[model samples]
Target: MILLLGGTTEAKEVACCLEAAGMPYIYSTRTEVKFEGKGVSRFGALNKEGLECFCFTNRISCIINACHPFAHELHHTVAAASLNIPKIRYERGFPERAQHELVHYIKDYSEALAWTENSGFTSMLALSGVQSIPHLRSFWQKHRCWFRILDRQYSKDFASRHSFPADYLLFGLPQEKEEEVTLFQKLNPDLILTKESGLNGKLDSKIEAAIACHIPILVIEKPELPRAYKLVHSQQELLHLFQHE
Candidate 1:
């Protein structure tokens, strides 16, 4: 059995592949969003006893980890558990957009904010997820901004405590064209901030929205992690990996 540490669009695609290939596996989730493929075993956040139960009840051999990079807790604990189960982190690569000379690369969001301070963007949108709240709240609070977040409001409240405006955005992904267009119009943003979360982090629509609205973008590049295998942007390659396994 495979324990798929799922929470991204790529997780669903992987599930599709698993079903098509006729494999049985478990899909773990903390949110209400249902995975695409059926016949998946379900589990939520596993406690210590729960982990013991999981280890005892199943012959789980491989873990298909699809959680985001910033989700260090999930990756560290579940992905690094003491079992015979080998883990393959579905890594996220960079987007294919052409880099202009104007686009700057920084280590993380704090540096990104430092670079932007007083330089003045027409407007800014933060899509780095909640992990980026410290940099945004502490430094980039004065800018015209919007932030997409889950229901927890972790990032939003943090930003609020640090004097960020209360009227910022709280949203989700894979938006349609009209929705993107609507956001583009509503924000009238000139700069878009995002992370490099590859295929699973489905921000393609948002990118299209920004480009369609002629807005420039800022990206928080993905930080490299150990023991993670990156899948090339082709299924043939993925199949080759599976075959070698």
Candidate 2:
């Protein structure tokens, strides 16, 4: 059985490929999602011991990791657990449009905050999501910050629990460059903060808006994942890997 750690779009594609190939597999996600794949699926996180037990019990022959790029901890856990079993990392290709002069890339959130402190920026609109709120809290106390979170009950609850001011929160991801431009005009922010979520996260729209407003945008670079048996950047490569391996 193949153990497919799936959550991203690539994961869904991989599941579809596996189904068509008539390959026995188990799909797993960190959280419960509305999965349409007609195969065995499991929800919830698994520690090293738990993963090892699952691999052993299910006779897992291979592991295909198709998780979010910024899922650092999960990546380490998966790499550690796949020492004996063959593992392939299905990563999304970086968006070609991310290359530009106005876009400043930083190593991590801490660096982003440090740079913000030195840059003399007063107000910022963060498109980096809810996970960034805690790190930006101190920065927020000193300057104006608007955190855009998903329009979901869980996201709202999490933000509320963190005591993020209701007024400082913006819901929903911007679907178009014009929508982002409208936000920039209304906020008149000194800076825009985001993560390198690649093309899938619609980072281009954010960049376009920032450029239109002549605002500098700071991006937290995606962390490197551990080297696996195979690393594939597209669905075709992933499917080809399964065929050869």
After superposing candidate 2 on the true structure, give the runs of residues whose Cα lies further than 4 Å from its correct spot: 97-101
- Residue-level lDDT tens digits of model 2 in 165-237: 8899999875588988988999998889998887777778888888988899998888888876488887678
Tell me, by lDDT, which candidate is best: 2
- Per-residue lDDT tens digits of candidate 1, residues 17-77? 7777877888887554555667565756775456647856877767777777666667656
Superposed on all Cα atoms, the candidates' RMSDs to the truth, in angstroms, are 4.2, 1.9
Colliding residue pairs in candidate 1:
none
Residue 75 in model 2: shift from native, Å? 0.8
- Per-candidate clash tally: 0, 0
List TM-scores for all candidates, in order.
Answer: 0.72, 0.91
